[model samples]
Target: MNVTIVGGGVAGTLTANYLATRLRDEVRRKEIEITLISDRDKLLYEPGLLYLIFNRLEEKDILRDLKILLDPGVKFVFKRADKIDLENREIRLGDEKLSYDYLVIATGSRIVPEEIPGLTKTGHWFYNLDGAVRLRDEIAKFKGGKIVVSVMGVPHKCPVAPIEVTFLLHDFLKIHGIRKSSEIIYTYPINRVFLMESVSELVQNLFTEKGIETRTFFNPIEVDAEKREVLTLEGERERFDLLISIPPHKGSKVIIDSGISDDGWVPTDRYTLKVKGHDNAFAIGDTTDLPVSKAGSVAHFQAEVVAENISAEIKGLPPTARYFGKAMCFIETSFNEATYIWFDYETQPKFVKPNKFTHWMKIAYNRMFWLTARGVL
Candidate 1:
């Protein structure tokens, strides 16, 4: 039996490792072959993008080459997938076509800055590697002007990223000795500052103590590149030296075109990670519209279930593993301190106090990137 996986992000790479190691016994017993295809040869460490954005980390330090992670039994196809042919149980990649008995689609979302007028041409984004690098260079040249960090829409990757960016900006200005001249403002579309009321209250309090301005219930309409202005729906005009914006995020057009996803995201059995309307197709990570944060931890958790289920099915046994919506994040408040929040669907988020242990833990996790690249982690 052959298994095909698409995407090389946290979901795909972690899943590959799990299946290759923990399920090696099953693979050898059942003669199962695994294949992973992706456009890039590297698995981007997204959480470290924040450090890259601030120029504290180098791009080379965070990028994990995928070739180093694939097991000998698993073949890696380096190409962009053009189409998903569900009828033939195959995937089209340019001139090449690959067939599989079981398919997993994990091609993640992208930031469509062009979706909003003048956004791509004017705004600075820090969600991806490229955007983070661009923002880093731009922030360095900034001579103390209004820096507005804003969100375009919801269902974005790493919901706390924008908040973290704002806090970092506050620290950045103070370090550069321009805190008085540079104005930092954070704006979002949500009614609350964060998804949870308790967390939102903490964020709002932090903003107040830091003297960073807050704007809620506001939607960005367009960016005036020539005039360096952001126009909102309420006709409010804000002049900005750098508009750090999170562009509108959407799922892969291929998933939408193939009619596998609703509004570009695949609707799956949240408990099983199985794509609806298909028995053999599964989805993991940001590709699925799960009621959880579209973060790496959630993707890793989902992959654990998907890998176990795939092993069970290969043995003609029922999938006994179930997925629970669990996600946690270490929100970096500053270089000196951070808070770790752990939560699930059944329980409210519990915030842990800032300490050196978490900072060291974060540092240790960053070091794991190198091991993960070599398929050791």
Candidate 2:
């Protein structure tokens, strides 16, 4: 049997590595073949981008070669998948076609700053490597002024990132002796500061203590770069010297072009992690339209379920694993302190008090993330 996985992010990489361990016997017998397809040759630790923007971590510290991370039993294919023919169980790669008995779609999301007019030209973000590098330069040159951190859309990867960046910016400016001259403003689309009420309350209190201003129900429709203003759907014009935005995000174009999902997100079974209507195919990570944070932890937890189920089927065992919307994240309140939260489908988030210990843990995880990609953690 041939198994094909598309995408090289945390979900795809971990799933490939986990399957290698589970199906080692079958692989040695030459009865099962595992192939992972990715467009890029390097796998990036995305959470490190937050530190990258702050110059706390360098580019080389957050990237690893894809071939080195994958298990030897898994074949790595460097190619961009053009379309997935679900009916024929084939993946189209430019002029070539690859067939698979079982398919895993781990295609992740992408940031679309162009979706908001003028944002591409004037705004800054840290969602991708290039954006992080550019933002780092901008942050370095900034002296003092009104800085705005806006959440333009929801379901973006790393839900707490906006809050974390706001806190870090405040600390950064304070360390640079510009806190007294700078004003920090945070904006969110909903009436509350965050989707989780508990988290919102905690963050709101922290923002208040840090003297950071917040605007609720603020949905940015367009950015007037010339006027240095952000026009909102609520008819508010917010001024800023520097605009750091969490731009709108969308799933892979390949998923959309293949008619898998209208908006690129694949319809997935939240429990089994299977693509809806296709038993032989599965979806995980940011590619799924699940009501959960599009964070790495979510992808890591889901990867286990996908790998286990697929391996079980090949080994003639019942696949009983199920994902329960498990996710965990570390929110940095300052350079030396952080807080942590974990929640599932039936649980509400309760963040721990910010402390130095948790901050160290977050730092330690940054280096250990490579082990995670190799499924050694």
Candidate 3:
């Protein structure tokens, strides 16, 4: 039987790798053809982009070739998926169609800059590789001003990123001898800084101690680029010299138009990663409607469960593997220190003390990204 996985991202790559190395061996005892489809031939290691901004990592080092990432038993198809036909068990890639017995949708999220008026034309975003590079260049030239960093909406990949950016900006400005002159503001609609109360309190205290202003429940309604002003839904206005905006995100049109997603995200069994309303379909990574944080660590755990279920189905056995919604995130506070948070659906996040070791773990993750991208992890 052929298993076709769409989107050569963390979810797709890890799921296919685990299925081939462990699950297929215990069940099928024979090679089950695995095909991975995506628009690009490389897997981007995104977590390291923060280090890349400070010339700590090279751009070439942040990518791994997809051709080498898959196992010998897996076929790599570098093409943009047009649609997923669940009824016909086919995936359309432009003019071509690939038949599949099982399918995995990990196409990830899309940034809609147009959703926030003037954001696309005036403000800046740094979610992807290209945007990160542009923002790096723009930041290098900025000496000092009101640097506003914010999230545009919910369900954004790596929710802690905007806060990390704010902290990093603090360090960046200090290095440029403009820390006192620059005003950093972080605004978000969430009542708390993070999902957990303890973590939120810690982050809030850090922001307060650092002299960075924090604004909660301030949903940005409009941006006046000419005047460097931000108008919020609460009838409040804030001015900034440089606006760093995280535009609204949505599921890929391919997933939505294919009827696999609701409200721009694939609805799935939270524990199984199986797409709801479809038996032979599953989703992982940033594309799924999982209750946990959308981070690479969560995707890795979800992929394991998904692979087991797929393998169990092939063996005519009940799928016993289940996801526990585990996710861990390393919040970069400064170049010297970072904090870790571990959480699951049943428990609130508990903060781990920051030390030199935490900083080293962040550094080691850079290497893990390379190995995972190559499907070895």
In order of listing, the candidates' clash counts read: 0, 0, 0
Per-residue lDDT tens digits for candidate 1, residues 192-283, read 77878988988898889898998888688999999988888876778888899988888877787777765678888888888887788888
Cα lDDT tens digits, model 2, 1-377, are 99999999999999999999999999989999999999998999999999999999999999999999999999999999999999999999999999999999999999999999999989999999999999999999999999999999997999999999999999999999999999999999999999999999999999999999999999999999999999999999999999999999999999999999888899999899888989999999999999999999999999999999999999889999999999999999999999999999999988778999999999999999999999999
- Model 2 regions lying over 4 Å from their true place: none
Q: Model 1 segments beyond 4 Å from truth?
A: 25-30, 370-377
Give each model a TM-score. 0.95, 0.99, 0.95
- Give the per-residue lDDT of model 3 (tens digit) for 1-377: 78889988888888778777754454344446788898988888878677676667778888888777776667788899998998899999889999998899888887787888777667887778777777778888898889888776887888888888888889889988999999999988878776667888988888898899988888887888888788888887889888888778887788888877665688888887878878899988888877777788888888888888887888788999888888989998887888988888787787776666897888888887767655566
lDDT of each: 0.83, 0.96, 0.82
lDDT, residue 157, model 2: 94
Least lDDT summed over 10 consecutive residues: which range in candidate 2?
A: 344-353
State in Å the error of residue 216, model 2. Answer: 1.0
The weakest ten consecutive residues by lDDT in model 3 span 22-31
